[model samples]
Target: MPWCSTARLLHLRSGAAQLDRLEKGTTGLGTADALLALDCSAERHHVGTFQVPGDVNDLDFPLPGVRLESTNVIEGDGANGVACITRITTGPGVTDYVTHEQECTYSTFGIHVGQGDRLAFFGEGQNISVHLSDCRNDVGRPGAEITIGLAVSPYRVLTIPKGVAHTLDGLGGVVTRDEPVW
Candidate 1:
């Protein structure tokens, strides 16, 4: 069964306005919970799933031969704070793979990547809710949307394909590191 069946049923019975309020967190529901309460089961055509690897080498990359350094934390002896690092190594003929990081203070919506595929890895203790829509058709044309709730841990990766629109909720203080594959 889809994760948001009850939420979908509520949307069908209530209306989009209620869902909108839920999305905006005006309905007293937590932002992440509200996003997960949305109905997107019917529109998950291109939304990918989390790749939880038993070992770093077992990861399935969206693009072949793409290599990335696992998330590593370096502890300081006494005076310095810990540092986290994630590095991307491009393969042959692959010139550039830039990793970007964003720390969300609140729910952010309508994020779209038009150039290339994006691999997003969240920091420790991140509990995020994502709403993804595949907008591969002509501009302004609607496509399938999928809502995913994730408790992000180390070594987990989520792929967002180019031309897909996505939203992140309940990300206060959560840092999201994205590696773009071109």
Candidate 2:
């Protein structure tokens, strides 16, 4: 059974705002080693790392609407299946958003980008940005405030660990899905 089940829409104004919240430590996003043990499969997706060009001030901040789809698994074989699914949709002119998983549960974030839209990941501390494609490609400089471009795909899922504050930039008309595992 799922330990937590909740969902809500996050209307994010800018990446700067999200970064500020993370720096202030008010967002309540974090990571843990115990949670890392739950998802060993994530290691294969860990991939390589790269540095983000320019600074956070160089990008255009767009307003993005993020639909949080957190659902409880009513029935499943183990941790690999789900019997029920939930979805939420938003209107145009809504883009760019940020979110974090709760302390104990790990979340798999999937992003599907629309035309003229791009996505990047910003993690607190030493956490690196990841991109999922045919091969693993990790972007962003460790401990630096930078935005790295993430390719859009249904198969691209970033496993977010506990205690790690993270947010995405340039999610215009993008579909963001969050599946939390405990």
Candidate 3:
């Protein structure tokens, strides 16, 4: 029988959001069990997914091979600092560790992760959830080079629009990074 695994989507409102083809392989790290994903929308600025093609050699993470940090970390209402919040890290790209908020473009954006350095897969063909275009280099295609996955936060789908230059701000939903996630 084909081991069918479903991904609990980060974008779903209700019901079981399962990645039909995704199965658990191995978990590299799991502390608080946060959400993570890779953005695959060619247009970018919008959340999407892209599979790791057999022909593809490089990873499409953000520019300079970013190191994602916890920006909009919110402590649970009842839980204080003691409450373990969101903890994120790249499983497959350990060696490709880039600084937090590193600047990168498609041609300029790429990260390196050893065979085991990347994020953990629940099983072969397992799909993880990502925020989708968590950071956009520009409104145009310059940002399209960046391919993303739910680097963390596997359960909750969050869309944070932290505008450019780290100075522009918007309303609603509590944006903390100033980096728009499309």
Best prediction by lDDT? 1
- Tens digits of per-residue lDDT, candidate 1, 1-182, equal 11232233222333678667767778664556446435333333443544333444234433222223344444457475344444453622232323224544333334322234344444455566666654443323234555656565545445565544556676665556565554
lDDT of each: 0.46, 0.30, 0.26
Candidate 3 lDDT, 132-154, residue by residue in tens? 22233234332322233332232
Residue 167 lDDT (model 3)? 13
Cα TM-score per model: 0.43, 0.26, 0.20
Model 2 has a clash total of: 9
C-alpha lDDT of candidate 1 relative to the true structure: 0.46
Off by over 4 Å in 3: 1-44, 47-49, 54-57, 61-118, 133-182
Query: Residue 134 in candidate 3 has what lDDT?
Result: 23
Q: In candidate 3, how many Å is residue 104 off?
A: 32
Per-residue lDDT of model 2, residues 1-182, tens digit only: 11110001111232456446545655554322222212222112223343433322232211121111122224557586333322222324343444444332224332111122223232222233332221111222111222335443332233332212244434444445443422
Candidates sorted by TM-score, best first: 1, 2, 3
Off by over 4 Å in 1: 1-86, 89-108, 111-113, 117-124, 138-142
Model 2 TM-score, 2 decimals: 0.26
Candidate 3 Cα RMSD after full superposition onto the native fold (Å): 19.1
Ordered by lDDT, highest first, the candidates read: 1, 2, 3
lDDT score for residue 111 of model 1: 32
